[model samples]
Target chain A: MESHSGIAAVVKKTLNRRYRAERRFRRIGLAAVAVGLLFLAVLFTAIVSKGYTAFQQTHVLLDVYVDPDVVHVGNLDSADYQGLIKASLRELFPDVKGHRDKRNLYKLVSSGAGSILRQKVLEDTSLIGRRIQIWVPADDDVDMVIKGHVDRSLPESQRRLNNKSLAWVDALKEQGRLEKRWNLTFFTAGDSREPELAGIWGATVGSFYTLLITLSLSFPLGTAAAVYLEEFAPRNRWTDLLEVNINNLAAVPSIVFGLLGLAVFLNFFGLPRSSPLVGGLVLTLMTLPTIIIAGRAALQSVPPSIRDAALAVGASKMQAVFHHVLPLALPGMLTGTIIGMARALGETAPLLMVGMVAFIVDIPRGFTDAATALPVQIFLWADSPERAFVEKTSAAIMVLLGFLILMNGAAVFLRNRYERRW
Target chain B: MTTVGEIRAANPRMTCRQVNVYYGDKHAIKNVSIDIGRNEVLAMIGPSGCGKSTFLRCLNRMNDTIEGCRVTGTITLDGQDIYDPDLDVVLLRAQVGMVFQKPNPFPKSIYDNIAYGPKIHGLARTRSELDQIVETSLQKAGLWDEVKDRLKHPGTGLSGGQQQRLCIARAIAVSPEVILMDEPCSALDPIATARIEDLIHELREQYTIVIVTHSMQQAARVSQRTAFFHMGDLIEVGPTDRIFTRPRHSLTEDYITGRFG
Candidate 1:
């Protein structure tokens, strides 16, 4: 009786120890999840806080004379409208007669101020020989003062904007001539040296064109390849090798796809460099293996009985696959395609190799036009020395992330809306 | 005992001659000769893995779908060799439909499930004609009254018995000459099993029915003729009543008297 009691006591002790270990494992899992969520929250907060200001820009409104003699109506695109802009600033503060002070005052407005007048003159020749009130962009240094980024208590030599230019910003504000509007130009223009004029329209358009080509080429080809391999391909050594290689290709580094594109598409095919067409062809190759794998999995998940029913009804193999299996597999296939697109959207290295890293001011008019995608645009801006570009880089990242979230949301919505349970 | 090679029906719809089957060098069925008569219920009964279901599938060549599965010898439908290389398997399957051990309905509306076969066969041209076929198929399977109000509901939502009947209705919609049931009631409750048994009795009047079942009682209840198989060999076959009451082979007698199976 004493030995039996001792064995029972030991069993009880071991059970309690196992229970305690189980509790510790649960707590560890909870901690791991908490750490993951905390990282995501910190990243989202940092990016939003650093980039949200890019949506607003400061502008100085001035009354200027669009004198035809200064603009030269015949050659409006090349005219030095910079002189007229400096003259307008001088007129605003006529008391600053010294050349060095006048130069410091001229620094308050953006260097693109001349290009803005040049665009306006070309847009409407009627503006020539007439005086009109125009909103010229405030310079990056002046913009920081207006947005409260510059500390006024600092010594003049310690800051980027001199005391004279900083005082001019306050004077303009007091005169109700300097104001920050919703930066519409940021969405309307393309890449520019001036941060206020830089917009994502070119990159966004390029992304759409590239995605169109990639999706169009990959989806049909991937589905066909998947259907053949999963359904019709004979069980042979050659087909098995192809299947193994296709799966391995999905795990290959995306940059290798870029190198392949450079070697074959640019050198052999002679496709235009930096065009959405070339970028799209490269992305298609990168995304095909993923789409094909997903397509085959989706096809396999459809019950064998469904195929039997179709066959029992006298439907041909192709007929049953296209009619029943393909529809049932659609939701999974679409989810995979969207994920592939999201990965393609953030790909910058391959696009860089194909010359999408070049500074392009004009928006791409077609698929063949030279273009830079969003991530490449971010890559370029992030490497620049300008302080305002820091904000632009983060904002472009936010835009790219927004598109990814939208694509993921669409995937979930499709799965829920069309999901069929058996 | 008609000399082992001459187990034939008077009005045979499908005839098998020295049929053997293999799954990658593992012989699954030996030389078996049998005949499935037209417009009658023929039941093949055996213990598990006795090649009963394998023999039934040979009629429609459904085993062709399995990888590494090969069939030799001749199986004929009507008076033609179905194993001929030029014979269309699609058409053969349409002529001989199948019902599985478990009810398998397409994930579609009740109306669509019945209409699937008809649409593929082009048996109906106008919308009303298609609706008529769906209604008649459902009515013929005795499911129309229960599901008439919810034709648009998915077929998978039906009860076990109803889904099996739906599969039966779907098969008949293609107007097949023979219907093969591979233990159609094995997955159902006793009550559901009885309903499917009654459905088999009703369907045997128009279609040649071949069923493989483990339960001797089910075979005795529904089949006009029964063939008993043991260890991939056909042990005895006769009229259903005679096979149960007076088995000619000791193996069949052992199986029937519960001595050994």
Candidate 2:
């Protein structure tokens, strides 16, 4: 009796220790998950705070008197457009003088401002003789001063924009000439070497073109591969080998796909460099394994009895797959495809190898044109030494994240709208 | 329950001789032979994995879908060799339609589910004709009144028994000569099972039904003839009444009397 009681006490202690260990393990797991979520929150918050400022831009409204002699209709392209904006700024602040002060005054407007002045005269030829009011984008350094990003108390040697540039920005601000406007041009215009004139239009359009080709190529080919492999293929050592190879293909590093594209698509095929078509072709290879694997899983998840029911109703094998099985599996396939495409959208390395990392200034008009995708745009911006490019990079990240969210939301909606429980 | 000497109905619609099924190296069904009479309810009662469901799938060549599953020997329907290479499996399935163990209605509307088979087979030439086929099929399955107003609603929203009946209605919409039911009531409650049994009785007047069942009482109640299968072999087959009252085979008698399966 005494031994039995002792044994019971020992068992109870051991069980208590086991329970404590279990609790500790559970808590550790929960803490790990919490840490993961915390990192994501921190990352997103950091990107958003840095990027939000880029969405609004500073502009300087100028009333430049365009003398016809300065820019005749015949020589409109060769106008001293920068001198016109400089003269306007000089008139606004007549107290400033000398070559140094005059150069500082010209720095107030965007380097692209001269180009804008020329565009204004060319658009309405009558403006060449008239006093035209126009809004010109401010230079990035001067614009930073107006937006309170520049420290005025800092030594002139330590600052990117000196007191001379700050003085002109202050003059514009006092006269209600400098205003912050929603940056529509960022969405409409193409890439530029000047920070203020650079926009996401080129990269966004390139993304669209690449994705168009990626989706068009991957969906049908992936679905067909999945159906044939799952439904029709005979089981043998060779098929088993094929299955293993397919899974391995999915796990292969994406950069390797880029290299393959570099060799086969660009070098061997002699396709156009920096084309969305080649970028898409590379991404298609990277995306196919994901789609095919997910599509097969989607096809597998559908109960075999559904196929049997269709077959029992006299549906041909093709009819059974197309009419019954495909519809049932479509939601899963669509979600997988979207996720794969979203991953492709954020992929930079494969696109980089296919020469999609070029400084493309024009929005890709077609699949065969030179273009830079969004992630490559972010990469390029992040590499730039300019202070404004920091905001541009983060803003590009925000856009990329937004697109991913949209794709996931679309996936969820498709799944919910068409999914059947049974 | 007892099994008398083997019995044969007057007009056999399907005749199977030495049918064998193999799933890889596993011999799933041995040489099993049976006759399914025209427009009569034939019940196959067995314990699980006795190949009754497999044999039912054989009727429409539905076994062809399973990977590594091989079927050998002859199965004829209405004096036609169904395994003929030139024979269209699609047309054969239209004639020998099947109901699954679990009710599987398509993700489509009730009207569309019923219309699918007819539309695929080109049985309906016009809109009204297609509507008429759906109506009569639902009526024949005894689900018309309950679902008449909700024909456009998804078939999955129906109750369990209603869904099974909807599946039945879908099969009949194809105008099949034979309908194979593989444990159609195993998944249903007693009340639903009883409703399905009643449906089978009424359907026997028009289409031939071969139901694989696990319930002895269900077999006794619905089937005109019962075939007992054990370990991949047909042990006994006879009139359902005689099979219950005077089973000749010891194993058959043991299985039906609740001694042991």
Best by DockQ: 2
Model 2 reproduces a share of the real contacts of 0.93
| lDDT per residue (tens digit) for residues A1-422 in model 2 | 56988999999999999999999999999999999999999999999999988888899999898977788867888879888888888888898889987887888789888888999788889887788888999988876776678777889999987777776777778989999888887788778888899999999999999999999999999999999988778878988898999899999999999999999999999999899999999999999999999999999999887888889899998899999888789899999999999999999999989999999898899999999999999999999988888888899899999999999999999889887665
- Tens digits of lDDT, candidate 1, A1-422: 56988999999999999999999999999999999999999999999998888888899998888878887767788877888898888888989988888888888888888988888889999998888889988987877777777788999888888777777888899999998888887787899987877888898888889889999999889988988998889898999899899999999988899999999999999999999999999999999999999899888988888888888778898888988988999898888888888889888988988888889999999999999999999999999877788878888889999999999999889889987766
Tens digit of per-residue lDDT, candidate 2, span B203-224: 9999999999999999999999
lDDT of 1: 0.88
Candidate 1 regions exceeding 4 Å error are A1-15, A66-81, A115-132, A148-158, B1-6, B257-261
Please list the residue runs of candidate 2 whose C-alpha ends up more than 4 Å from where it truly belongs after superposition.
Answer: A1-30, A93-101, A130-133, A151-155, A171-176, B1-4, B7-9
DockQ of each: 0.77, 0.78
Which run of 10 residues does model 2 chain A get worst, by summed lDDT? A142-151
